[model samples]
Target chain A: MPSITVKNLSISFPLYHENTRSLRKMTHLFISGRLRQDQHKKILVQSLRDINFTLRQGDKVGLIGQNGAGKTTLLRTMTGIYEPVVGHIRVEGSISTLLDPNAGMNFGLTGRENIYLKCSINGYSKKQTQEIAESVADFSELGAYLDLPVRTYSSGMQLRLGFGLATAIAPQILMMDEWFLTGDAGFIQKATKRIENMVQNSQILVISTHSAETIAKWCNRVLWLDQGFLKMDGTPEEVLPIYLNKPYEEIVKKD
Target chain B: MSDHDPTIVKEPVIDLRSVSLSQNVKLALTDLFQGLIQWRLGWKLALLDIKLRYRGSILGPFWITIIMGAKISTIGILYAYLLHLDLQHYFTYVAISVVLWTYVNGMVNDSCLIFTSSSQLILSQRLPYSIYVWRNVFCNILILLHNLLVIIVVFTIFRIVPYTLYFLLPAAILWLVNSLALGIIFGILGTRFKDIPPIVAGVMQSLFFITPIIWKVSSLHFNSNYVLLNPLYPLFEIVRSPILGENVSASIWIAAIGYSLFLWIAALFIFSKTRFRIPYWM
Candidate 1:
């Protein structure tokens, strides 16, 4: 019964420049007769435009786009981090996002402690965090190393610990930026398997990835973003070929 | 910030609109209480912060007292003489005042950076933004609790048993309401304005001298009327006066309560409207 309804969503961020960030400079400008009322202008970058989508249980969607095509913006928008301008988003379940694997895990705290810390921020109660502590430790394969600070862990080890917690949270909706965070060969293989299972089992999965083959293999549906607009929305089978053929930029170049 | 049940009980779980005053109040209260109800999370995060700050040190959060002790005793000796007050009574006044002042000081200073420091957590996860604010307030409170040990040792040495130690509870609640309101306003403003945190630091530096933490207010025969207008003065009085076995001044209590109410309303208006902008700003 989990669902997400995003209607005509758009997002933009005000871009601040060097001079604009300094209140002192701005005030000085005002006093020195260097600043006119119209001189103070705010610049905004529209990252997403009129995006509309519905995700019910058992929807596996791939968000495909170029560098600035608003893929990550859309994911963050759903998380309620960035409020949409002129749109409504009604998410009917708890959400877990893998925007950054290392985002919440404290480097200074021991892995076990960080599990509690990370899970707490992820909205787990202390008792719930305790319940999952064992499983998280086991899944990470950090063993006694879990007692050591995360700063002591190798980069790969840190990634494992992060991935373990991200998957273990088990929220109804799972959103990831790059589908999988690749490390060395062995670690990436293990991570891929774990993520595949987690993503498959989650009630809804929306991932942004550059891997067309992976999209073809995994996604039931695909969304292609051209700049801020939703250019194409259909099954991966229907949209992937068209996306691969035109690539948005080349179409813009022809125009 | 409010978590709805996963079951589809309603058609629209969230509404999108420009922040209205009533809706803003509801959002602010819901977020505030959500963080309060999850006090465990805030407390744990506070502990982690304290542990990390004092890692590899024997003293841990005792550093708070060590610094306060050094500052208070040094100032207590000189100021007691200058103000023509007894050393024991003066030291006691200075000790309690400093602890309370540090709590407000640290809370105000730390509040601005709460969102910026936790930008990673805010972006990657969706929890109540108030949780981070609470964690910071709780961390400062934890430090205050540690520094309160300084007050106990100081009190015992002076053989001055506390008259209304229990009153500190309600006093602490009042202090929290004030701090939470200020913290939210500053957190939101700090997120939007890069200049705010350092500017706050400078303002606080100046305000510390103006607010009578080290210097006794009663001892100040001149400029006392203007000092009465300082909102921070009543804030210090409510907590410190009780422990000193003095009746809480109605003027001070009224000023502090009115200030807190005004701030809460203003903070809510700002917070609810700008809450979503925080992540983007950060």
Candidate 2:
């Protein structure tokens, strides 16, 4: 029953200049009629343009795009981090996002304490938190390291902790960025297994990455974005060649 | 990321255009209500804020008490001698006033950075915006509790007992409400306007001298009616007079309540209009 319906969604960020961000200058300009003139022509960076899509149960969607092509913006919008500018996104399930590994981390606290903090933020019960701690401790394999401050953790160790915590509870809809996959090979393998298991139980999965092989192996559908527009939307067989500018067989074999 | 109960099927209709003024008000109220419900989380975050700030220190949060005590004793003695006031009574008066002023100063100064300081957690997930405000309120309250030790010691040493100690409850409640209002108003403005934090700090510095904290209002030799116009006067008087066992006039209570109501109205207006844009500003 989990689904996401995005309707003509467009998001733009108002680019605040140095003077515009200052209240003193803003009030001064207002009195001089310059603020009104500036208001008529404000600068905005269009992060996402008129776009429409619907994701439902059993859908495994891959978002393929270059840097600043709005893949991350789209994911952020779906997860309710950024509001839409032109249209709406109606979400019908709980969402879990793996957008940033260091998002909620307090580096001064021990890793175990951070786990408790995050669980509390998410409104988990005491019993559920204990279970999550055990799962994260087991999955991350950072036995004694869990007692140390997270600031002392290596990048790979931090990734392990973030990944394990994010994946501890199986969500109805999972949205992930490409950075989650960057780590040691063994960790990657373990992470892939964990994601695969969650995807199997989850209603929908949306991943943004530049890896065509990853799309070929995992996604049932592909959304190729170029310069803030959805350039193509179809199966990997139909869209991969058009997006990668190569034969479908070549991209599939590359996996 | 925010996690929810999968069993409860809550459909979120994310439409910014559809968020009318009334809807914005509702959202603002819900945000405050939900935040109050999550008081435990706020308390925990506040405790950690105090703990991590003084981590590895010998006395931990007691440093707040020591620092306040030193300031009070130094200022109390020096100012009493300069003003040629009675030593014992003036010292006690300054002690209570300084402690209350520290709480007020800390709340106002910290309110500006409440949202901006937690930009990391704000951007990562969705929670009631008031939770951040409550976190700030709780942190200041924790610091106030630490500073209270100094006042307790001062009272015991002087053998001074406040007769109207019960009045402190309503005064503390008023402070809590005002702190929350300040948090929401300044929290939003500080995030949108880069100049607000410094402006707030500068204004607070001047107010500390203008308000009757170190100096008594009775010594001014002018109509205290003009002094009553200063909003902070009543706020300070309501708390300080009670602890000093002075009678709190009904007019002082009225002014404190009036200022609180004004603050909440401003806070609601600003928060409802701009709460959704906070993350984007970050």
Candidate 3:
């Protein structure tokens, strides 16, 4: 059996607004006991529709899409952050998601303490988390400042700490959403190498990124999504050209 | 040699419907399990929340102690004169009530914002939504500790005789259960309704006067039914009776425990069903 499965997933958002005229119309219908159902039919925005796929061990799948094409939504749904309005997602093993690198840290906490808190939040055992804390401190290179409150740290320092803690633990399935770039050039190089090592041993890795270069370099296969629909699925070389060369003007005009 | 007797391998059939149903169950289980694990880490996060709020200030959390002391002393003196009560006795009552009320107030105000304040964490991580509630409760306890300092100082200044230490046993249990029950209900409701916190604030302000925070329950001339009708009355009695060295009624204990358990179960049911909907709503 595949490690993870997603079938016919759809998410819809309702638009709600109150207008004086509509309220009056609703009140009139209410008094008559024959309310117009059509008046309140929700304006649905389908965020993800009929998403079907299977993920297996050693599969590095890159999810490519525009901002509103449901890239983030899909990743969140996979991590169980958001439930699908329709369909389902299954995972056979524990999954670690780095949807946002700074997700659970308290800025008031020192870097060392935040490491333990975050690692535990990510489901690491107390002893295992403490073991990783030493390594994270070393990797982040913030030195004695690791004992100071994270709120006092610069953005680069925060990124380094967040990135270090995230990449320290090995998970059965890894999900990433555009948090790969750590900003500092040196830290980026270090982080890339660390991630590469982590991914090699990871059973399943699903990454969502707008950068075609990242998909080409990191993913073995690419799943192209456009407007919440899977447009293409194949090797990076096979899908990237078709996705990049599509007529942007015509696509926007269609909407 | 094997070509003559080849073995056939068949691929598994994909049942789309069953697969989807199983996925839903798996996701639900994962969310429940995550909530349990995250509960353990919530206290640390809550401490961080408290510390962050007062960081960089010279007085630090001590400011909580100082402000509470000044407010209670002013009211204690004024009320003692107006009600013709002994200054020492009135001061002790004011000190204890104010400290306890601060904890209750903190829980009510913070419960509504638990989900809203932790939006960044909830949206990004596959964490249990209950962690926010636990964090809010834990942080309130830390603030309550700060307020305890003021209570201790007042006790010393008034030279009140030390009552039996056994008073702490029931007080601790009652406060814990009360905070947890109220936190869960308010946390769930506040997340669902945006207007709940402000309304809760208004209600609590009214409750402070009616619940004897500034006056003795014995001093009120109203019927006993009025006190019985107030939901917060048992909770106040649980905390105040022991501190005042008075006996707590068994009926009050039964009511407090019964009401808290009922609220807890209801909150759990609602939370289990609606926690998944929170990210979308937010």
Candidate 4:
């Protein structure tokens, strides 16, 4: 019953002069509220423009592009993270997105505590979260380290914990930036197997990764974007060969 | 990564549906209410926030209570002597005043951080935006409850038992409501401007001294009534005066209720108009 339909969806980020990277200028702008918006030039980054796609149940979508080609922005929009400024997205399913590992953690909390925190954020009950916590801890294999603060864990250890907790839920729509497999070769193999199984069972899977090999293996469809424009949409066999033929730099020319 | 790749693939395959304006307003109200209505999500995050904040310290949040007790005792003796008031009555007044002031101050200052600090969770997860605001307000309330123990100990020392205890509930309830509404607005405005949190902190610092927080309203020879014109003065008096067993002012109750209604409307309006813009701003 899960379906994703996006039509003429254009999302442009508005960057005001006062809200720029400089702290000193922002302080001046803060003190001077009388200044009008038109007093300074406005800049808007057109992250996604006129993107149209319909993804039915069981569609494994592999999103491809160079850095800042709106791949991450597109995935984020589907989960309702970034709203489309011009168009609209209609998604009929419960979406579970693993966009970035860094944003969803409190390092002061233990691994087990983080697991419960994430579960509750997903709107799970306490008893349900407790059960999910057990599986997450087991899959992460942090063992007694789950009791210690997650700050003590290495970056690799943190990634494993994030992967374990995010993939535990059986979602109608699953979105991820990359295939989060880390640690030893044995652990990588185990993670790959788990991801494959989830992709098989889930109603839809949308992954944005650079590797053509992973797309060929996991995806039936490919969405290629450049400078916020949807350039190509086709089977991996048709698109991947053409997409990979060019170097990344030439393809990533800014608009 | 496809510069040479043709922009045209196929003619549009998906239906383009126009989103109505009403849907946005509905979504905004949902964002605000969802954070409050979903008590489970709010409380869990709040408890975790408070726990993590005091994790390593020995006395934890009780440390606030100890520091507050010392401040009250020292300030009570000095201010009462300086102002020519009875020692016991003035100490009790300062104790209740400062405790309630801490709660208000904590709510205002911490509210600015609700959305900015939780930008990570907001960017990755599909949560009702106001959940972070609720967590902030709830966390401060938890600290307020802890500080109430100091009040009980003070009451025991003064041997002033409360016969009109029920009168304090409405004032306390109004205070909590104000904090929740004001906190959400602060969270939204604070997120967009990026510099608002520090500016707000500076403003609050000045407000503490300007407002009749350390001294009584009657202590002012001139502008004593004008001092009550400060919104904070009425808010502070509503809760603090009730605890001190003073006569409740009808005008104070009216001003507090009227101001609270205005804040709720303004907060909801700004929140609904700007909720979608949060991701872009972040």
Candidate 5:
């Protein structure tokens, strides 16, 4: 069986009418004037609809889409971050998601402390985390400032600590969402090696990124999503061309 | 491509049959235990939060005590004269009540926003949500400590000593339980309904008048049965009774403990179920 199976997944979000007068009319009359008030106004855009796919062990899938094409939403649903409005997802392994790399660091906490906190958050025991702390500190190259509060660190420094902490513990299934870009040049080189290492060992790797080069470099298979639908799914060589060749007008013309 | 071809390198192997969200609870509980073990870690963060607020200030946290003292004394004196209650008793009532009330108010207000305010942490790492809740609670405890300075000063000025420190056992337990229950409930509700925090703030402000924090609970001519109708009345009594040297009712203590337990279970159930969805909502 595939490591992850997603069948007919869908999500819908309700949009409230924007007109002040229409809102007043609806409230006073106990009716929905959404349709009658302004037919021209766009309302209730469907964020994700009828998404279907399967991910197996040894699959390195890259997600590509225009903004609001449900890339992040799909990742979130797959990771059990968002409950699907419809359909079911079955996963067979321990998943570690790097949806946002800095999710657990307390700004008031020192970088060294934040590392332990992040490790504990990632399900590491105190002794195990303590053992790995030195390596994470060395990789981050934060030096003595590891004892300083995270709020004091520059954005690059923060990302260094965050990235170092997350990658230290290997997970079965790894998920990343457009946060692969390491801010500093030296850290970027280190992070690239880490990603390569993770991709080699991970059962299923799902990455959502806007960078075509990134998708080309890291993924064997690519999925192209447009307006909540999977427009294309194939090897990188087969799908990247169609996505890159699309005219902006044609892409936007669909209602 | 040949076996030696770089394009066809062997895929890395990883175990895929063992991970499941069913273990989310187990992991969360484990994380909770780990946090308890590292309780000192949370206090360090809590202290940092407190210190950041007072950084560069001359009086530091003492200003909090001074301000609370000024507010309590003014209200205590004014209410005593208006209600014709003895100034000593009225001041005691206001001092203890305000200190306790601040704790209640602080927890309720901050609990709802804990997840939202800690968005950075929630998104980046897989930390247990309870850590954020506990951190906020610890911060409130610190504030409660600072506010207690006002209580000490007021009691000294009035020369009102407690009959026994044993009264504090019930009072402290009740206050802690009450705050914890509120924290859990508000923490879950605030995550679910974005509007709950504002609504709670409004309700708490309104309940301030009805709970007899400023006025004596005895001053009300209402029957004892009516006291049971007010949820906050029992909580206030828990704190106020000890300090005022009034008779602490067993019935009220039982009800408060039962209510706290119920709220704790309900909050835990709801929070555990919905915590996974918070990232989506955000």
Candidate 6:
């Protein structure tokens, strides 16, 4: 029953450079009765413009876009990280986002403590926390390293901990960014298997990636964004060829 | 094992829209109430903050006690000598005043950084914004608890008994309420205006000297009633006089309560108008 609905969503970020962020300038503008005039000069980067879409159960949607094309913004918006300026987004399920693996990890805390902290942040009960700790400990294979501060761990070890903790709890809606896929062969295999399990259980999955093969492999639908606009929304067979400037059969065949 | 109940009753909905005052108030109230209900998380975070700050050190949180002790002793002895005041009474008065002042001053100065310091957690999670404010308040209270040892030693040395210690419960609660109000006001302003932290620091610097922390208010020749005009005066008097076993006038209590009420109103006004913009400002 998980679903996402967006209506005329337009998001713009007000660029607060030194000029606009200063209280002195703001106060001066207010006293001079020039606040309205200065408001006209405030810079706003329209990250997403008039984007409209609906995602429902069983839809594995891949967001394809170039750099700064609002894919990440759209995902973040859906997660309620950023408030929309023009319209609304209605989400009907619990969401877990892997936009950044280390988003909430405290380096000063031990690996086990970080796991507990994440569990507590998510409002997990004590028994559930203990279960998650055991599961992450088993999956990460860190052993004694779990007792040490995360700062002492090597980057690869940190990745294992972060990845394990993030995927420990599967939500109704799973959203991810592409960079999470990078790692050694063995780790990548394990990570992919876990993600696949999560995807299978999730009511809806949305991933933003640059790889056409990723879309062809996992997604049932494709959403192509260009310069903050949703340029195309349909099945991969209909949009991938034009998006990649290659035939759809070749992309899937190579994968 | 990953099974979830597909039949979600009252599924959460986020209906975002343009900034409207009424909607902002509703959201702000909900956020504040949510944070209050999750005091456990804030309490745990506060404990962790204290633990991590002195993780590698031997004394751990005792460091707070040592620093405060050193400061109070140096000021107490020097000022008692310069003013030709009785050492026992002066030291005792200075002890309570300094401890109370530390809590107030720390809360005010640190309030500005509550939101800015936790910008990472703020952006990544969609929890109530007031949780950060509570975390900060709790952290300061923990430090104040550590500093209590210094007060206990001073009272023991002077052979002075705090008979009205029960009054401290209400006084402490008032301080807690005021700290939260300051936290919300300054937390939002500090995150929005980059200059707020420094400006707040500078204002607190002058206020410390102006407030009767190191000096005694009785030493003033002018009408002592004028000091009550300084909102901080009544707050300090309520906590300090009660500890000294002196009667606090009903007027002081009224002023203290009145100031806190005004502060909360202002805090709510600013917080409601600007709570949503905090993430973007960061």
Q: Pick the TM-score winner.
A: 6
* lDDT tens readout by residue for model 5, B1-282: 012443355432221112245655554565456556666656665777888788768999889899898999899999899888899888898888888788888889988987787776665544446677677888899999999888888889889887667867876876665565566568767876778989999998987887778977667776766866677777777767866678877988877777777776776666556555565545
Candidate 4 displacement at residue B54 in angstroms: 1.8
Report DockQ per prediction, comma-separated.
0.41, 0.45, 0.29, 0.31, 0.18, 0.57
lDDT per residue, candidate 4, A1-255, as tens digits?
678989889887666644445877445434533222332455555678799999998799999998878898898888887777688787876677878765578899999888888877877766778778887788888989999999999887888888888878767688888847446787788788878878887778899988776786789999999767899999887787688885433333321
* Candidate with better TM-score, 1 vs 2: 2
lDDT of each: 0.80, 0.85, 0.75, 0.79, 0.72, 0.86
TM-score of 2: 0.93
**lDDT (tens digit, per residue) of candidate 5 on A163-229:** 8877776666888887858576777788999888877777689999877767667788888888778
Task: Order the candidate numbers by lDDT, best to worst.
Answer: 6, 2, 1, 4, 3, 5
lDDT of 6 by residue, B1-282 (tens): 334455635566666667688888888899999999998898988888889899999989998999999999999999999999999888988888888888877887888888888877777768898899999999999999988899999989889888577878888888888899999999888888778889988988898899888888889999988888889989988888877878899999999999999999999999998887787877
Q: Which ten residues in a row have the lowest lDDT in candidate 1 chain B?
A: B8-17
Runs of candidate 1 exceeding 4 Å displacement:
A18-41, A125-131, A246-255, B1-21
The alpha-carbon deviation from the true structure for residue A229 of candidate 3, after best TM-score superposition, in angstroms, is 2.4
Preferred candidate (TM-score higher): 4 or 6? 6
Residues forming the 10-long window of minimal summed lDDT in candidate 3 chain A: A30-39
Quality class of the docking in candidate 3, CAPRI style: acceptable
Clashes of 3: 0
**For every candidate, how close is chain A to the native chain A in TM-score?**
0.84, 0.90, 0.84, 0.85, 0.82, 0.91
> Which pairs of residues collide in model 5?
A93-B19, A94-B19, A102-B124, A103-B121, A103-B123, A103-B124, A103-B125, A104-B125
Fnat per candidate: 0.56, 0.52, 0.38, 0.47, 0.18, 0.61
Clash totals, every prediction: 0, 0, 0, 2, 8, 0
Best-first order by DockQ: 6, 2, 1, 4, 3, 5
State the weakest 10-residue window (summed lDDT) of model 2 chain A: A29-38
Chain B TM-score of candidate 1 stands at: 0.90
* Model 4 lDDT on a 0 to 1 scale: 0.79
Residue B88's lDDT within candidate 1 is 95
